[model samples]
Target: MLHPSLAFEKGVPSDATAIPMPPPAPPPRPVDLPGVAPAASTGETPRPPERPAELSRSAPAGPDAARPAQTVKEDGKAGPSDEAAKAGETVKPTASGEIPVPPPRPADLSGSPLAVTVAPLDDSACRARLERLGARFEALPAISNGQCGAARPLKLTALADEIALTPPATLVCETAEALARWTTEAQVAATRDLGQPLKSLSIGTSYECRGQNHDPDAKLSEHSFANGVDVMAFGFAGRATISVMPATEGTPEATFLTAVRGRACDFFRTVLGPGSDAAHANHLHLDERQRNAGHRLCQ
Candidate 1:
């Protein structure tokens, strides 16, 4: 019933409501096309395409950025691997797929007390005799003071038979030669009588730069020239020790001590023991001193 011009005009009637037509159905997606994504409904705007994780990871980090450091085990601790790098070494894989280990370092002996070494004595004759008797000795320079000194000194460590001296001694070669003979003849025989072989001799004194009996005003003692030694006790292999003292008298130990003293007179010019003066009470003093008319003093 409305006129043609009114019907074509864009106006709403007072009593009527307008029903909008649904947006044209979205253009049919091109299912047959390759590499083409389906479009969204016409009214909505499309979001930018999402980037792939691989592309994001391929981006390069700038220099000066911190990198993950390698780990190394040091002294049982985990630490950075800069030590090897600083040393100009590289960690490379071996043919067997194993890491090569470094060689172990030798033990440090510089600070050890036992590291001290003494050179061998320079006397050929003395060295030959010691070598023949299986004695261990080191050559030492002359020890001198005022009018007293020991020349051609030797540091005795052990006998030829591997008998170790509890405490080694320093002596003149001549005295050592005499002592070696005495040890073979007197000490060995005496200890054999007791069914206990001699292990070592406990020496009280050897070389000293002092006067007789440590008297400051007296003449030089035989010890000053390394021509004397004081034997305090004899140690046997079974931990048995016999000291030269009056208390050991009236026992088998006394018999052995007396026998050795008697035998020592043949080798030493003077031999003093427990019954001698107070200075020689606790030990036997044997010395190779020049005597008058080849006479010997054995007390």
Candidate 2:
């Protein structure tokens, strides 16, 4: 029943006043990520978002990039980190990319210069060596008279293993022991090889109280102290005799004598034979005369 111009829209109340709706909520404001610049402030050019500080610190860098600086203490000195010290590890800066090496340890010597020990010399060692060679002799009183003396003398009555002598001789124990070894190991062995088993030895001179070659004015001979002995000839079981002389050369007897004389140097300090001098042209002379530096006189 209202005029056309004044008629309300279909469901509006006739008495209601006109009300304007609030403007549509402002479009949601754009959210800005951390470290990102606002779009309005930066104009229309879209920029890549910046990473956070923690992410940047963890990211790996290129080989040519500068390394992070080491942290210095407040006292102004740079040192290893606490974790590295606790782990017993050190980090050293490379110089020209070269690695560092530690020095080698020294060897332990235990206060000794040599690895082995040597036993001290004993006085009875000589007698022990002689007795082990099966020599038969009685110990005699020592003789001493003005540069002419025999210490620990023994009356040597036999040579090789019970082989008796035609006349027993006297000599110092050292010389007697040497003679015994040379006779058994050298002379007897060589003669037996020549088909002559010796039974007895002929005595020449032993314990002579004289100078060299019986010269009264010369220096005392080794014989004056019962240290030298002479072997004139070797007697076999059937009364066979082989004299030690150059005349017997080229014969088995001469070979036997030469073999024995050469080996005597091993046992005796001095060995004299037919070619030595006119005085020793007929017999072999053996003695134990201590020389400097154990130099044996084998003539």
Question: Largest lDDT belongs to which candidate?
Answer: 1
Q: Write the per-residue lDDT of candidate 2 for residues 177-248, one digit (tens) a residue.
A: 778777786545555657757666777988878899888999888999898888888777654687888855
RMSD of 2: 26.9
RMSD per model, one decimal: 26.5, 26.9
Q: Which tens-of-lDDT digit does each residue in 1-299 have in candidate 1?
A: 76545654646332244456688878886878765345665645556889986554322257622433234353555343464446433444479875444444466844556767565355678668877877888988888777777757888877745666657777888778777777776556655667777778888888888888889899989998888988888788775788888755566777787778888888788899877788898998988898889988889
Clash number by candidate, in order: 2, 0
TM-score for each candidate, following the candidate numbering: 0.56, 0.55
Error of 1 at 169 (Å): 1.5
lDDT (CA) for every model shown?
Answer: 0.73, 0.71
RMSD score of candidate 1 (Å): 26.5
TM-score of 2: 0.55
TM-score (C-alpha) between model 1 and the true structure = 0.56
